[model samples]
Target: QPRHSKRQPEWHQRDQDELVVNQPESATLDESQKPAYADQDSGSNKRKTRGIQQENAKDTVVLSKEISEDSKLAADKAMEAMGANILTELKEVQTNLKKQITDQSGLITKEMSEFRKEMGKRLDDIVADLKDVKNRVEEAEQRITEVEEFNMDVKDVLSHTLQLQEDLQTRLTDLEARSRRNNIRIHGVTKGEEGDNLQKFIENFIKTELSLTDTTLGIQRCHRPLGPKPPSGSNPRSIVIHFLEYTMKELVLRSAWGKKVIQLKEKRVFFDQDFPSDILAKRKAYNPIRKILKEKGLRFQTMYPSRLRVFYQNGPVIYNSAQDVSDDMRKRNMFEAAGKPTEDASQPKPGAFSWEGASGIQRWTRETRVKHIQEKLRAFKHNDNTL
Candidate 1:
């Protein structure tokens, strides 16, 4: 229960100094320095000395115990003070470390918040751009649909217009052909052979060449076709003869058909019905088919305005175009029957009527030509009588 001191305890230092002084005193005292009773108290002095030694040892033990107790108390107090200082320092360090951690956590949270906001803004921008692209794609699809519809309409209109044009062309060709029904074309006559009076010259030439002196020919007009005249030795321009009456024209044609060959001024001539150039072109399209039919020995007749009447074993089939004829021939397995053509097949036949003059008629026997002419004449006479 002693009070604590900063320096060493004063009681401990005083005890040490007393022990030193007493040690020197006990060591300096001698036997000669003992008093007059020394001899009489020698035994007593010896006993006293023993008692003093025992007392000193007891004192020393007591002093040592006291010093040791003081030292243990001081050490315990010093250790307690050092422990209190260390605890205070540790508390301060922990508080500072906690504050630093809180500050760092706040800074990190702020940065994370900013990053999240930026990422959200970028996402919104991307979504808006995607919406715009979707709208544009829809608009493009709508425009494409409109274009497709417009294209379909244009195609329909174009198809209708083409059909209408084809019909108009057909009607025009029919009218042109009908207008030239009573006209006759005379080919292979020399240039200027008809002289100034072309109508009279035609009438005279027909009557003499066809032996039609008894028949009356009602020739309304006669003239060459409107074109530049041919050079010498080339083919002469045709003479178009327009008859006043269709029946008289038919009669003349029938008579001309009866003759194998007709000559005018010692040159061979040809007679045929005149048709429009369009009709002529359509008939010319049948030339390849006609050659094929001729090679196969098939009987086929070219009707007016480019119609073909093919005589088949089953029945007679009529075709308006060479393509139809070809298809039918293929179906009947007769297309290959024509086979390869000879070198001379492409060449024109001698004394044969030209395609422009005779509507591309094939060569026929004299009897067949006569028979067809008779039938046509009878039909003409019946129609005339009916009118």
Candidate 2:
């Protein structure tokens, strides 16, 4: 039922004729000279028609096969050309990759060598600096040792110098005490009592007080000792007298011992051998004992340079200091504890021979002696209250 284009047998003949005409091998013929199929027999005509149809069918088949062959050849040619172009591009890419890998490897090797050299140089410099530090440390240690030795030597020198200074001070004090030996101090004397002629005033004073007109007592100089005047209402300053001979000073001092006070123009004066400041300080410690000895009518004298000498009937007892005298009094038991008289009346009196204790030896310690002196003072106070 669908309509299709109808094929014409004459069209195929015409195409074949055109092909034959264009060929040099084909014959040229007129239409009038061609055989007429209408004038032939029916059997012969049928054969001719069948033959023509078969020939036409053969020509169509040949044409279709030729066309298919040509198409297949064209497709093969195109495929080969495209494959060649792809292969060429792939080869070029491989070459470029190889060149890039070579260049990068060379650059990395060069940079590594330079880095190694720089590290080696820095390590060498560090070693040198450490050696210099070590040398400086050793030098500092040496200097410290020397300084310590110098300090020790300086300390020894200072200690020796201090000891020498103490020795010098002791000798100087002794020299000063010796210088005052030939002089006497007349205490409680009114200022200006010497009048204008100081020498004549002293000569008259000795003659009148000691009744020494028969003896020749040589006098050298007389004056008020150097010092500020006493405050108003206080005792006047003493007259210091120097003798031509030390014997004359001793004579005047001995004669004035029992006479506790001397009178000069209605003023009570006292006489003492001149002593240095240091010895006077030492003598002040003996005042308590001196008062007791005086009341007992005991004959005791302070010897040259602050020594005390007591003349007992046996002989003389010399003491270097007031502590020595107190120790002696303690052992002798001259004053009893609490000031009561000893019950043993057979114990000789204070001025007797027993005071010279077994050829004058001490048996008590310093502390015991001090305790005895305190008890004696207490006993004296108690006895005076009872009286």
Candidate 3:
């Protein structure tokens, strides 16, 4: 058998509306048609419908595949373009970043060079300043050394000058003391009573006291030395008598030495050599020691200008100054004081016994200062006793 061929019917809207109105004709045809023929038609119609549906499906698949191919090609082109653009942008960004890095590196290198130069210049300047400071320090040290040397020379010159001045003063004082060797100060003499016959009256008194009437004693000026007169009703001014020979003065002093009081017209008087004030002060300092010697009956004599010569049993012991005498006496345990003796004599004397609450200055103890003060006070008291 041959395969059955089928045709699909096309129905318009007007043809379907006309068939609806002609339904009796369709019924009469159905009644007259054979079963086989009707089955054939129906099968043919079903086959035609299936064939149309398959064709439509094949066409739709082709169209869809074509559309998908077009869309995939367009997507591929777009992606290529986008990828090219992204690659170009990335290259540009990389180039720009590389250029910026290069520029910054160059700038940093230049800045570093400039900084190096600046730092080098600063270091050089600092080195120069340090050198200058070192030079200045050396110069200052040199100048200080020179100043110290100059000060030393000036101090040496001052010391020599002071020594010379002291020597000159000592020589002058010695000369002055020697000059007054033949002079005697007759204390407690009635002022203005000696008159023009002052030398005659003194000679008469000397002759009567010493029995030197036969001796021709040469007399110099006899008068009161220039000074403030004593207040009225006090003792008369002292008479200063100058003898031409030192022997006559010595004879007068030795003769009057044992006498407690000498009378001039029933008024008591005394004779002493006219010594310098300094020598008088020094002589007064020896009185205590002298009294000690006299009491012990030791042979001691006051030497020229206030030196003391003690005739110790061992030999002659001479003391040049009051300090020397005092030191020697202390060494020999000659006397004792109420307070303990100071151990260190080199320290400066203190102003008082209680030095607490005082400024922080090293000072001698009370015992040392009191010893000096007592020495001076006793010396002054001795002077009063002599007067």
User: Best candidate, TM-score-wise?
Assistant: 1
Backbone clashes in candidate 3 total 0
Candidate 1 lDDT over 213-262, as tens digits, reads 98788888888888544557788889899998898888888878778588
Tell me the tens digit of each residue's lDDT in model 2 across 1-387.
Answer: 111123344778696687556633212334454455433544564685587668877866776665567666766777777788778877787788778877877887788788878888888888888888888889988988998677556545544554554466457667876677788988887767777887898888888898898887787788887664567998887788888888888989888876767898787778887776556656766776676677666789887677899877788899987777777877877545323222222212233232224457535433234334444555554554475
User: Per-residue alpha-carbon lDDT of model 3 for 1-387, expressed as tens digits?
Assistant: 111122222433454466467544333565556454565665765786687667667755666666677777878999999999999999999999999999999999999999999999999999999999999999999999999788767655655665575577578778988899999888877876667788898888788877788987788888887754466998887778888999988987888877767887788889888987556766777777776566667788888777899988789998977667668767876665422223323222445432333467655454345346545545554554475
Candidate 3: list runs displaced more than 4 Å.
Answer: 1-129, 148-171, 190-216, 226-238, 263-268, 291-299, 311-316, 337-387
Model 3 lDDT at residue 318: 89
Show model 1 residue runs off by greater than 4 Å: 1-128, 155-163, 195-197, 214-216, 226-237, 264-267, 313-315, 332-337, 340-387
Give the whole-model CA lDDT for all candidates, comma-separated: 0.75, 0.68, 0.72
lDDT of 3 at 143: 100
Runs off by more than 4 Å, candidate 2: 1-163, 214-216, 258-260, 292-301, 309-319, 322-387
Of the candidates shown, which would achieve the greatest lDDT relative to the real structure? 1
Better of 1 and 2 by lDDT: 1
Going through the candidates in the order shown, the clash numbers are: 0, 2, 0
Q: Against the true structure, what is each candidate's TM-score?
A: 0.52, 0.41, 0.49
